[model samples]
Target: MAETAALAVTPAGVATRRTVTGMLHSWDLSTGVDGPGTRFVAFLAGCPLRCLYCHNPDTRYLRDGGRTPAEEIVREAAKYTGFIHASGGGATVSGGEPLLQPLFTAELLHRFKHELGLHTALDTSGFLGGRATDALLADTDLVLLDIKSWDRALYRHLTGRELAPTLAFARRLADLGKEVWVRFVLVPHLTDAAENIEGVAAFTASLGNVARVDVLPFHKLGAAKWRALGLDFTLADTPAPTADQTAAARAVFAAHGLQTV
Candidate 1:
């Protein structure tokens, strides 16, 4: 595949030439990953979390995606500005992990807001932290935070990482009064337990800024990506979550008055 054109902006109002690497393209009128409405999604390269059910394994590499300058992405996505605004949509910077590229995402969001007056959203796993995270959130308009598993043990098991930091980060985001859309993958026999769901619901309710909750049914879409990369797929035998399973989990949040869908 050919690389995307370069678009770079320096701090002093200078635009530099560069090339975009590992850039993937998508132009669909479907609902945002969080909900309904057309969105121009930019799937950033790399991720720190390794959720067992992650479907975008290709996105986990640190630098697999080409170095598409922030300006280039903003420019390309700008084409859909009209439709995005009219439909109450905007650019969503998702990732292997968008938080990993805070500077780039910030630039994109800043440009989209200041230049195009477009809404901006970040779909994050709530993992990355410290100064980088703070900078990214500073410019983000809305956040789609994925609370993988409520139980600390299960969270570590699912993503091979600690959960406390992510939970704390969520609280911090809430304290900042940022609009948050909490999402959880309904993984049957793993993450959809009644207790876990309730625990997540309670935690989110405590935050008070979680505008909505989403129950994304577990799928194997990332299995292929794993295979292509010559890695063993762990969830090969795992089946996708059924509608009833997802509905039941969604009900847990709704029952807690969490406005889940």
Candidate 2:
């Protein structure tokens, strides 16, 4: 669990400060991918799933990250607010599953939305979606939801977790009328099956709030990280989907009447 500093109290026994902290992997600025324009992306550490193609395998454990206060992260983002806003970008609280540290994630989202005055996005696998509170979702403007596979068995094999939770979460998000961008990574010989892609496309299209679908091609960018962590990169030889294959997958979503990217 991420550590939280004890609340400071005044002489009258009134609480003055309460610092919500969590394990933070790192943060960076990115455009076109993370969200909107240019985003100040906070990559919180600790995830519930063990995805086979995770590029940031080093962020799998909380111990691998530094304990960071929510205020500190907000302050850092505040610095780039001008640039971020100018670029039509915002702040994204991503993970090792930000929902793992719900309180900290909430604080950051609230501050980013109210204090920093920026669009907020939550990039999550949605496996821990139940952990997210309504208030947390209220502060979020967009959700970058990853629905890795449509096949339950394939999803389990790929992420070491069931796909039901993610599906349920997607439904919940849809019911709430929240804006969402569905992300699907197309892995050759794994998630590239037509049926698998169709399953994802059909579900995403059925969600009224889904704005677009991102058919990301699987890549081995994190293979070296896995090697450095002394863990086997299982998909080391699994080739990335070809352009034609990726386009075909996007066509599936487009056929379902979803805006595909």
Error of 1 at 131 (Å): 4.0
Residue pairs with colliding backbones in model 1 are: 21-66, 21-67, 22-65, 22-66, 55-222
Model 2, poorest ten-residue lDDT window?
1-10
Candidate 2 deviation (Cα RMSD) = 1.2
After best superposition, candidate 2 residue 150: deviation in angstroms? 0.6
Residue-level lDDT tens digits of model 2 in 128-236:
9999999999999999999999999999999999999999999999999999999999999999988999899888988899999989999998899999999999899
Once model 2 is optimally superposed onto the true structure by TM-score, how far is the C-alpha of residue 239 displaced, in angstroms? 1.2
> For each candidate, what is the lDDT?
0.77, 0.93
Instruction: Give the per-residue lDDT of model 1 (tens digit) for 128-232.
Output: 854346656776788888898899999999998999878888988888999999989888789988899899999998998988998888888777888898988
Candidate 1 — worst ten consecutive residues by lDDT sum? 20-29
